[model samples]
Target: MKLRSLFAVAALALLVQVSMVAAAPVVRENGAFSCTFYNDGETESWTGTPGNVDWSDAQIASVMRAMDTIAGLFSNEASRKVNVSFVYVNQTIGTAASAVPLMSTESSPPYAPKTKTVWTADDLGGRGVASGSAASVNNLEDVWKYGHYLPSDYADVVVTISSALHLNNSLYYGASASGIQGFQFDMETVILHEMAHPLGFYAPGRSDSKTALEVLTSVKSYAGSIDPKFFDGTTTVAYLQKHGMGILDYPYAAYETNDMASLGVEMSKDGSHISKWVGYKDILMGDMALSGVVRRNYSDLELAMFKDMGWSLANDPFVAVPEPSSVILSLFGLSGLLLRRRRTA
Candidate 1:
């Protein structure tokens, strides 16, 4: 009898394992997260770049993983998919007083050269802690900035990264976790954040090659109605990120709208970066930072919240139905009746 029961239990466990693996839906190489790798080593060698423009295989995988994480969350939470493509470049990079590369190849729609601007962060008015809490907006001139110059053929959104940033063997950065003592940035997090910028996650945008319009839109997105999801655990952010799930199809929201909640992100002093501001209290992982380095926050309420967002939050879909109030009431009433009978007896 014991042997039979053990065998049955083993079979059940195997079945459960298979079900769980099958349910999560593996990410394929060709789908929404279809990433393109680039190397910024041609000009510098900080992490793993051998030359000024080459990337090692390990560096490529790290960024892809970070994209996968955010993508996975959106996929699971919003029940949709986001197609992502990446670009690696070694444009003039440095701190605040940075070098801006003016290349003819960078001239195009949405890509602008923001070489002549200096930005400072301040409050919306005379205010409190909330003012410093978000990133200040930097004006990006598509006519003058490089975002428009980026090759847009076969690209919906493009993500660029640093070669040193992806190599964690020494300074180790990227998404895996704490890096070797050398690097401070996370490659995966950066990809996730930057990718969000173009997909309408951070702001609404237009494909206009017109510099004035995109700059205006980017500034607006930083402080605009941060998707309540970024602000809190509202279902809206997930819904926006994942619009198509299983056979169900959801319409994509406009790429530029405050409809998504946020902590108010703006550009850095150089206008080269944008995200939830740093050097302040760390925003939760999932919370959208003004910089490209964080993820959507998570808490115990995560499962319940995703369910409300319309994603299947059940551990076992067939068995995950909520408890019926009627059943509970019946059980309580029956217990009370039995207690009364005993007292009378």
Candidate 2:
């Protein structure tokens, strides 16, 4: 009887060990970038919930492909590496989703907790690191500006997507953005957008107080002219002056606020994103995305912004997306087809 009891206990221990191994989160690594997806059907402590929803097979496959594509975008390019942790949870986010750099430590005086900056002199190619440069002066303008790159050993950012997306079937999880349908949001596009934030396209507590009309008034100054000199770093003054909105010695008194309206630049209401200004809506970092639209390329302006933020581009980040006219025509065709189907039915 004693021997039989010992065998039963040993077998139970083996079963528990196997289960633990199976419940581990899935990790995907690409060069210096890596993403950890928590989709196993088990309770994750990070979520602060009992049991997390498991990502569907299709969802997992689609996101895995997106990770590969995003990895390629920064392949061998970042001056430093980053790791991100993604979790789907049943919780309230500021929006349907959010991305935040994981808190970290800095070796400076006071030794406050802060992430390292990604846009260091090495990545910016010494562009804005000089004295009196805009980039260096405002490096610590905001509370969150202490650093941008999350620690590489672990996830520097935690990207949280509401489980509501899963329940509502709101996202199109196809491998290609071109396959997006009229009623579905492109999954890859959303991922790319959120990824840009932690990759150094973020600042906290800033507000884009300008209305669309106010921003439009200054559009002609910088619409067609993009120069490297425009990125010296003070709000949009450096950008505007280079394109003729202001003179070389534009007065310093006008920069009292972070509003870029005077420079024809607009950001989201909360100042968390670049506004989808007319003729520049195709930028990947733009604030809004409509259903059936696939925004994959970073505009030249965006690349300059990243450069200002301190990252080295390994490959040319510019790629032409479908023209606005072409996109409108395709949407019209899709609408007509839907109308015909309704009539026939």
Candidate 3:
């Protein structure tokens, strides 16, 4: 009887252990953003939330840390919230990862005026529209003219990450401790890049033209000359002037000149990123992700671009006020502790 009881107890303990291991991972939240990871239910190699494919605890934590870092970059405005659902797709989805902006808002007329007047008659005590011009008295500037007021709302962006590509977590946990290794892609960097896309860093396309102007007018005319407000020459000039560069020369220096080419301020097809002009390498928006090690932080030029996009960095310590060394040291220590625990467990 004693032997039978001991056997039964051992069986129960084993069952409990298996149950604990099978439990789904919990959702993680930081600031105004909440992340829920899901798996496609087909991949045999990955692990995480049950019914969802596998993602190790460390990988999930690293994603959360990436979110924290991005959240720190923006100042709170109008209680806008963002919920990111990170779905692990089985196949490659265009450049390792992609983000779809679920919702976005254009600022009132002062920021995105519908027409430009070639000539105004102040002599007549009232402005007059040029001949054949569609100029109206209701002209409003782009959202940026409002001073750091971009789209702010709950669940503004939804991102999907590819499970097909092997991701490196070392850089996510502080690359110094993980040591440099070749070939593996940095997951955190990818997340940061994808996150920026939803924050108003996107190529203007027909979809925007359709939805933005549909309600206002039935006209479906395609206007290629009207540059994206964020990427226009006006904003670029301001950004260049901030760095003491000549505005006139920026078009040549900052834009690409070949077929399928565009502003060099945008992602470069070659390895050289926009930051190269400013003497930095591996900007977050660079077209290609190179093998071997890469830095986790955005370059000064990248941050300036965000500023030009109308995001206020007044609260971001990385912009002007340097983060205290002690905070960084503490974070490193915590990361090490978590890694050690993960290894031992």
Candidate 4:
């Protein structure tokens, strides 16, 4: 009788462990407890609810294939790797569906204590959503929140598709399969560039402000005839620290052309670190190229950064994402990572 009782207890414990491992929070809007997505199309985000994937197996397979394509980008030629925890959410939700959750109380996060933040412009304030041009939806306000959701911990790369991403004069559509190929790299390149920012790829002296317009102006200026400098450290960093966390924004460790030239990457003829690797034509001083995945599969830099954050890129599962900015500040072997660009040839 004693042996039988022990076996029963062991079985119960195993079952509990399995439930905890596979447990995705049940989303319940009317009840009380729930999970949340920062925006629509966030991987399978649920509120006091669990996701329902009873879709045609074909759709599920396509989504999984898309995920695989994204995962392959981590192994980039530049050796910048990508390590992340996968959070799933729906591409859209009706008014009656439910809101996403966010834990805002922990002085330091990753501890929600059950509280969640819904995906809305009122809170996050258009951090990732695009503005200006015909794609502008700000006038609608609520319509703007329909963009893809980024998780609290964030991912090395965020690939979202939705009705909101129409190529109607929006800055995000330049590289989309629907628009002009940015006259340079494909849409994949831009996606890779954005991913590199959160992963700490640009030079350490990057700006963290919403200077997309400003940078565009500079790029235009340079295109016309002058030497345009769009970003500097203080400008963006100061703003981000004020709004979000400092390390959470850009310039934490940008790996600009100068930063990499010393590593024998061949920057440019002029000593200006204003570009890095644009697409294929100009490897300017400030331009960002393949991280590490501008797409080479994955990058060592990415693996190292993730490892610094206490997670192994190769050994870890896809669901173990750490805080986005947690390990970005870690100083890797300070080799030519900080060298000054010199006019050579």
Taking all chains together, the TM-score of candidate 1 against the true structure is: 0.38
CA shift at 131, candidate 3, in angstroms? Answer: 18
- What tens-digit string does per-residue lDDT give for candidate 3 at 144-256? 22222344322334455655563433233333425446655667777877776655444323322221111111111113322211222333444445655532223332322
Q: For residue 131, what is the lDDT in candidate 4?
A: 36
The clash count of every prediction, one per candidate, is: 48, 1, 16, 64
Best by TM-score: 2
Could you tell me which 10 consecutive residues in candidate 1 have the lowest summed lDDT? 119-128
Q: What order do you get sorting by lDDT, best first?
A: 2, 3, 1, 4
Query: What do the candidate models score in CA lDDT, each in turn?
Result: 0.35, 0.52, 0.46, 0.29
Comparing candidate 3 with candidate 4, which one achieves the higher TM-score?
3
Q: What is the per-residue lDDT of model 2 for residues 1-345, given as tens digits with 9 covering 90 to 100?
A: 999999999999999999776467766676555567777454433333333666666776676666666566542334444566777877643255677654344432232334223334543433433222112111111112333433234445677777776567667888777787786667777777886765555543223222111111122233333211122333233444555553223323234343344444444544346653443445777666677887665655566555444444546443336889999999999999999999999
Q: Which wins on TM-score, candidate 1 or candidate 3?
A: 3
Q: Report the Cα lDDT for residue 220, model 2.
A: 25
Candidate 4, residues 224-321, lDDT tens digits: the string is: 23333333222232332333432112222443232321211122222123243222233212343322222413333233222221222334333335
Name the runs in model 1 displaced over 4 angstroms.
Answer: 1-31, 39-52, 75-83, 92-153, 163-176, 204-327, 330-345
Rank the models by TM-score, top first: 2, 3, 1, 4
* CA shift of 130, model 3, Å: 17
